[model samples]
Target: MSQFLRSSSIHEILAFFGDLEKTRLQSISRMFYDKIIPSSLQQCFLSLLTKDKFFSYSKEQGDILYYYDIPTRTWIDVKAANHQEHYIYYSMSAVVTDLNRVLLIGGSFDPEFEQYTDAVYDWNQITNRIQPLSNVPFVSFDNGFFYYRGYVYIIEGHVDLFNQSTVRKTARFNVLGNYWQTLPSLNHANGKFNMCAFKNGFIYAFCEQMSSFYRLNSNLLGFERSTNWDLQYIQWERILIKPSVYFGFKMAVFGLNDNQILLFGGDDEFNNQITHSPISKEFSDANALKILDLTDLSLHKIVDDANQDLKIELPDMFYFNQLSEYNGKIYALGKDHIHIINLSKKEIEIIKDDGDYNEEDY
Candidate 1:
């Protein structure tokens, strides 16, 4: 048994345990499960063991909410129990807060309207019900959305479709108060940029088009000194180092730690010029996984053991891909597969979604 534990691959060990009785393998599985199972399997096992779930609601599937059951290898649709008003919102931003709810932010509700929406909704995970929350002061879509402390922040994004103009505006929604307040605007107008907040009280925003990076100190001391306790004063400062330019849509960015950020797959717009629009024929997906070191503003491409650039394929052309971190592993949810990324190991395991749950269903 000792030799089997050490010498056997995680998959092999799992297979061996599968043949044994539950009573015989339960304690053993608990003991070495973290090592005996692959990272993807570990995610599932941990989800079951901890009763913690990662919820996902795609813009393409605006009405339905789904969570992956890693152990069963299935996407379970927990029907929104109280979602009576079905409105299809596209290009929206979603953030899962610490309060076990998802806040869906600004998006275009209808293409015919040609107007962006400021509507916000809180979807309860436990009740599987969605309730309308406070709307944003400004209407926009394709914005940078994040949740920090007790507030939900939205950065620059497309504001007007007629002129194709973007905004540098920043705003935060107080979750507890259900009120929206505009914060200091960015120096440069940007849309489709990536933004994330760190526990260190700094919010980082990166625009690939302009090769610009900005950091805003959200702490009371940092804000008071910079703006004299004035919320309307400009607080965003352009960092000295800029991120490398990469043009794509629906790119995923998440902070790995206080000093590291991981950027994942997106639709490579330049490579697939024919499909420039979301409604185009064929979309090209960029697979490069890059990590930006916040300490030095150094961006490096992540590669596998073979010294080859690691890639993640985003199969869904219409929906924005979701990248989430749980239990130290990054989970990239594409249309067809879930890529379980073990950054520490520099390894990624792709698990194909169940065939029955296709895009057409949405």
Candidate 2:
């Protein structure tokens, strides 16, 4: 097609679909579908942009997939549809598998969503499609997903007041049996301020109460608190700039081979914006990602030149949350894009296109 016709055709198609009915909508949607999508897909494609529940992850083939709105319609490289699935309210949560499958935990969005999520799916790495796995009684979102000890851990919670309490609930999923099992109550259940797991048989949690910090033993059936890193024993050093907000997201702790934990990006009690609700008084903006050496409690910023390279304005919104070490390079996933941190070269490169960075170089 010529440029003029191609441009005009899209405009005409948009206009036609703008006033389409359900039957016509599906027909037109199907015509545009380059791939087959099941009719069981509940959520529509356009609604995904509005909802934050969709999952985003990079595949083994170096393709970025956004499993959004509808299960059967997957977005490739954050663009239009490239693949599809047949599910709804799936935990946009993404985890890597030994064979390289993308595990997604989904749940019903009913009242149960706050208390329970009973669905899970595994997206095959070879075909770029998703299949149901097992279900959990606790919803995935209520408790964030963390992979440790060959199983995915789901933490549960309920918010009562705007900024006051985020009650901690708990559950675990067995990858082998595909079932949900309850765990002991969190020692500090005020609300999950932020949490991450380390390979060193421990999961660390910091709360919004500002009174306690916890180190949960990974081996214990229930998350048993390790009293060594509790609140009263914490040593605080003076900082020129205090991280004022929680960033409403979990702080990521990366475990290095040298028995050191890299603590990066967490909110101090001063910033309330980190909480899930803006209606609450505890909302503030945090944009800095700090690296704390667990060995000596030494602190440093991940990006030395924030203004020049990082360009981070909102510490809470656009910060590194997930770090994966593949092929000797560390790939950090931030809010907007992925950064390839060359620890060897002490440099950073933003991954915009799938073809831009060769996987072999990692």
Candidate 3:
């Protein structure tokens, strides 16, 4: 016995689709595709935004480094540096590693002291608090920090701030151990310096007299220099030049959202030969900050150029130093101005008031 079933013809199918409303047909097709196809393929059909994450940047209420959750858009002030007996300084600059570990390095909060930096604080995201370490690190600044070999390696620029002569070579704090270990001293007595981190474990130390780039090997002890990256700058009115010399010595070094590394305003000894003053006379009067792209090794200065749509007001006297990126936006803490740059929009927004810190009054 043969079984017979009604088979829909091509004409019937075309007639059914032609008779359906546009919206109804679209809805039906979507539903059918979603039900029939696997999620991996169906996901390709949907459009997605650029995934702009949002985060907040705020000074600590008392004296502590804070972490803001990008997903939930919430701030968690880690009160890890508060002193119960005597209120000590809580100065910090943090780096989030590959494993998502936040390492808030040492700095001074109190301005009364000349030279003194407390212990390095490690805040584990798993625990949501500051983690304790066995070894205590000596005082240092963000100028001496670079992430290498899954560890935060530190270069002790100046041991004594008052002395200004005591040179403490270099060291590293194992993010895993939370301990401090010293590395080999620099080639010379470089008490003040700035380091730029690059791809393939390359770290560039840019200073006044000398600038050198090195590759941090897997052992962490192995450091090989690539070439002598000479430091110099010529003030041009409107020409584009690559910045080989780092102007921002103590300021912020940022990898921009637009795939560029921004070196903000920093102080350094004068290298220009055009100065009429004594040869020994060191000048820090140059206020022009630089923005360099590592991809093509191209450099551009942050100026009042009509071509570039800068969103924030550039700092005047105060050196804009520290850089921190949150929620796809870059926030810069100058000596006076707190600048927030929206990378996606290519616009800059400035926050004038800094709580208690005064640049001019000081």
lDDT of 2: 0.43
10 residues in a row with least lDDT, candidate 1: 273-282
User: Per-residue CA lDDT of candidate 3, range 126-241, in tens?
Assistant: 45455434434565544456554446666554324445553445556665445666554444433255454444334444333223233333334443332222212211012223
**Candidate No. with top lDDT:** 1
- Each model's lDDT comes to 0.58, 0.43, 0.43
Give the local distance difference test score of model 3: 0.43
Residue-by-residue lDDT tens digits, candidate 2, 1-362: 57546534433333223212323544665546424322322133333112222345532322345543222223344432233322224224565432223576545343334444457677654465556677666443434566653467665533444655434655567665466665544544434534444445555554332223445565555433222334333322222213322333444445555455544443342344334323222333233344545555454555543343232233322121356555455555544445455655546566442322222321
TM-score of 2: 0.53
After superposition, the stretches of candidate 2 with alpha carbons farther than 4 Å from their true spots are: 1-91, 106-118, 126-129, 140-142, 162-166, 189-194, 206-212, 222-251, 266-285, 296-321, 343-347, 351-362
Better of 1 and 3 by TM-score: 1
Question: Candidate 1: misplaced stretches above 4 Å?
Answer: 1-52, 58-63, 70-72, 84-86, 108-116, 159-166, 208-210, 220-234, 240-243, 270-286, 313-321, 326-328, 353-362
Pull out the clashing pairs in model 1: none
List the lowest-lDDT window of 10 residues for candidate 2: 353-362
In model 2, how many backbone clashes occur? 23
**Between 1 and 3, whose lDDT is larger?**
1
**Per-prediction TM-score to the true structure, in the order listed:** 0.69, 0.53, 0.54
